[model samples]
Target: MGAAQDPNSPVVHLPAGRLRGATEGGVTVFRRVPYAAPPVGGLRWRPAQPRTGWSGTRDATADGPSAPQPYTEGGDPILGGHGSPPFDDDCLTLNLWTPSADDAGRPVLVWIHGGGFVSGSGSLPNYSGEAFARNGDLVVVSINYRIGPLGYLYFGADGAPGAEESGNFWLTDQVAALRWVHDHIAHFGGDPDRITVAGQSGGAVSIAALAGHPDAQGLFRRAILQSPPLGLHIPTPAEYLPRTGAYLRLAGARDVDGLRALSWPQLIEAAQGLFGETTRWGHWPTPFLPVRDGVTLHRHPARTLLYDAAADIDVMVGWTRDEATFGFALDEGYATATRDQVVERIAESFPDRAAEVYGAYEKERAGARPVDVLMDLISDELFRVPCVELAEARAELGRPVWAYEFDFPTPALQGRLAATHCLELPFVFGDFATWSHAPFLSGIDPEVRAGLGHAMHQAWIAFVRTGDPNHPDLPVWERYAAPSRTTLRFDAVTAAVEDPVGVSRRLHHRASP
Candidate 1:
């Protein structure tokens, strides 16, 4: 039995089951497809196993359940509202959108949502694949993987029943999903050979981890890392063992069996309470992050990328102009800090180049408010600098790397927030009207803004299809290099810039991590 659909539906046969999706505006949309078995019960902290195949037709009309997360309200709502209802443990699923079921040679874009690895789902309306599917004629896939303790608990010598892994089980789930894509995307009109793994924030970090993994060597030929945090690579057990043990004990989990036996709500509460006031870091209530387990992740992502482990891969790396505005908005005082405090914090954060770097920003914008200065400094240190460093490192390896800076400030934020973190999502997804206050951001120039979306979306699709992003018809996107250090500036009118935020990069280079 199938849900009622338009007579012109696009039916595709997936390995798990046959699904029927509706065609809207020249694109086929399929939602809520499971890529792996549910990671619940005995499988909670284990590596994802292959999903058991289905025997009958399965409806792919809506989003699958999001991974378990704390219920809250009125903060950055990426996957539904902040107060949305809680979900279950079996949240390993994926959604797909394509131009046609017969267009088997089209490129594939797999998007990993960003919420510092805890919140956010692929089911957000802003992440819908319709526009990308219709405009670029490319296949888009978004997925949900385990998060928090369930996704990233670092197992120790306890070996409690299913506690077999040492690092990120969540990352393992991602690898499993990619493997599923390789095996089944062909049936849904996507070319397995032309896959691009792209993500932002924690998702970006995950992409970086995948890029470094030996198992992920040929899973995707290209990658796009947007705003990856410098500190997000899997940590060593030495760095997190105490915190992990404390969290386990707080959850009333005396052993692996006890931890597994704790209810999901009980686990979330224990993790939240353990994090205390520091939960602003966006998940990590416990010390649950990808650990440096020797097996899955051989080394840290940075070391792997720096050593040319992924040198052959094409990369597009970028950060926004005002990356830290969102962090400040989450807490107003963060933006209202004093100059001395800003410098002190910067020095603390980057002891290597604290004086030299802080001096440059302080001198350049001496009259600026403490919060504004802090904002720029934090943004660069956290996002911009790392992006540039990664690009520079990749360039040094003689790999083709393109760099970009998103400078368009969102109207919804008025002037308080510049092109802050995630502000470019609406433009990238071509859902500004649906996701943003269109009247404030676009005014009446819908057609003009619409053109940029077409161009940007096409550029991404081209990147996914061909390893290189330069389409002859589009603007010539030069590979990033030293000296000139050209970068594409995405805004109302996209153009190339010479060394976007060069001063900040220099300062960060001088500063230590």
Candidate 2:
């Protein structure tokens, strides 16, 4: 992609036809290229089909629409931006940034945005691929998959059209995107064999699951999972089937067609309650999760990865130092949390290991309040311990693995956020301007931004180019192992540390429901 082509021409000829791109900073940027047919009308719940070729040069200058999903309660994207971007059911497009059109065979990087499987699109400014393409001399691609009920709802009942194929249609959309890139990326000067899938939060969870899927094995060689909720349950048909009837009752739909006939607002209204309904394995009440359909996704993503399908690929897994601080301290949940409220929350979140979780966090935060201990407990149980376990599993399998702990505290909101969830996003993209109005990053200045941004950006670029994430900007990092659990702690003074979350790892045992 770095090799020089016709500088005046910003068009690439593909088998589908031709794509005209916009030039910015010496990189040709293409937005909203369809990887699959629109999932609307009769295709609402069907498996994604290949996007047909165009007859003429298609204009790929504008961003794509987001999938039909409900808005965040406050309309604030602490991870990306505020409010909802344009949305539609016919939203299945990808954005690409490449250095040039010539055959350079540069490594390809595919980014999957995180919104807890409910919101966020690939076209968000924070995931802008120009910086990655320009700096790394490569081609960067970010894709959009369906979210919300349309993405995760499981209706295992027969005669529900596509329900029998698989309930996790979002994962199907992801496979289609990778297949498109595998077949077509080389035409855009990217190497099909050098694909590296990188994602954060829910996107991380999706990528982790996709990495272990047998159907998705050869599409990508490596993966980067940032704060994946591995302990989060993947509901089977028995667990999710009843919710289908509840949805039907709420929407007044007698059957699948009746459900399809309803508008998005109606669909979202009926499904909204499911988001907060606590399941037996739910720690955060995320009911609209990837379903474990025996045909496609047979087991929990972590279990499938660790024990079976993850033998071939290499991965990097990590979490923020104070993941729950994003909610506890930033939203004033800490100040108002009652003793009983804290206890109930902890018990509900970790029913079986309540005592063990409490003791571990109490030792970790000595002299801290019960609420404070609860905050770290939720953080480790959902993210820290699960992340460590994932790396440890890869180490046990003798596959290459790298682990990290993002410890850079945001000085925003009067310095309350201490390395909270989604804080490291800007650094990875090297674009603080895109997140200019983000509340989590409000007070972090440009100088502090540049140092960390350069380090992470370089490290990710190196990971794409090579399998390893090590570069000169950070310390000498080693692969995560059992006894020492070597990890790279990224901060103002970044260094490699051993057994950073050793206490929590010992106390916690992840059992997927």
Top lDDT prediction, candidate number: 2
| Cand. 2 Cα-lDDT | 0.80
| Candidate 1 residue lDDT tens string, 1-513 | 444354456777765677877665667788778888898888888888888877766777777888877776544432225324547788898889988888567888999988766677887666788887777778889988988778877766553445684668888889998998877888888899888898888888888889878777788878888878754445676765666777777888866678888888888887776667334332223235667877787776655565556777788888888887776744566655666776677676667766666667767665767677777877776678878877787776677889988887655544677678876666677766456533225332567567766666667777877776666545677899887788998877788888977787766554222
Q: What TM-score against the true fold does each predicted structure earn?
A: 0.90, 0.92
Off by over 4 Å in 1: 1-9, 73-83, 158-162, 231-234, 277-288, 306-309, 350-356, 437-448, 471-475, 510-513
Task: List per-prediction Cα lDDT, in the order shown.
Answer: 0.74, 0.80
- What are the per-residue Cα lDDT tens digits for candidate 2 across 1-513? 421233454787888888878787779888889999998877777778888899877878788887877766555535434436577887889999999877989899999988777777887877888889999988999998988878877777573654555778898899999999998898888999999999998999888878767778789988999888876767878887777777677778877778788887788887776655544321444657788888668877776557545676778888999887765674454656665666666687667766666666777776866767766877887789888887887788788889999999888767666798889988898877777768788777677678888989899988889989999888888999978889999898788999999877766655422
Candidate 2 error regions (>4 Å):
1-9, 72-74, 77-80, 159-162, 276-282, 307-309, 328-334, 348-356, 509-513
Among residues 3 or more apart in sequence or in different chains, the pairs in candidate 1 whose N, CA or C atoms overlap within 3 Å are: 352-512, 353-511
lDDT of 1: 0.74
